[model samples]
Target: MQESRLRWYGHIRRRPPDYDSNLALHLSLPSHRSRGRPKTRWKDVVLNDMSEC
Candidate 1:
């Protein structure tokens, strides 16, 4: 699981800056959360794996 996430992360990193998946990682949405705990996002998962290394 971690391996695949890392693979895709590298794949996205190699894309042009304007590519959607690449850009999505850095883009923040204008909307606010409804309430309760925030979701576990894709970047959050990748970051957790990276920190474990």
Candidate 2:
């Protein structure tokens, strides 16, 4: 599941910025203080996968 998801992410990354999927990929949500920990981002996931490779 994760591998397929990552592969799809790669496809999305290759798309032009005007594409909805690409826009969504680059979109940032409003920031607010959190209690314990910060969330893992898509970039982090991709970096982790690359490091493993």
Candidate 3:
């Protein structure tokens, strides 16, 4: 699943910067303090996979 997701992301990256997928991927939200551990983000997963490669 991770590999396939990353592959799809690669395809999305090839799209123009104005593309919705690219915009969504690069979007960032304001940070806030949470009561518990933070969520596992897609970016984090991709980074881990990249390190493994």
Highest TM-score: give the candidate number. 1
**Mind giving the per-residue lDDT tens digits that candidate 2 earns over 1-53?**
56876798789989998999898877888888698887888777877876776
Estimated TM-score per prediction? 0.85, 0.71, 0.82
Which 10 residues in a row give candidate 2 its minimum summed lDDT? 1-10
Ranking, TM-score, top scorer first = 1, 3, 2
Residues 21-45 of candidate 3: C-alpha lDDT, one tens digit per residue = 8999889999886889989989789
Model 1 scores what on Cα lDDT?
Answer: 0.93
Clashes of each: 0, 0, 0
Candidate 1 residue pairs in clash (backbone atoms < 3 Å): none
Model 2: pairs clashing at backbone N, Cα or C within 3 Å: none
lDDT tens per residue, model 1, 1-53: 99999999999999999988888999898887879989899999999999998
Of 1 and 2, the candidate ranking higher by lDDT: 1
Candidate 1 vs candidate 3, TM-score winner: 1
Query: lDDT: which candidate is best?
Result: 1
User: When superposed on Cα atoms, how far off is each prediction in RMSD?
Assistant: 1.1, 1.7, 1.3
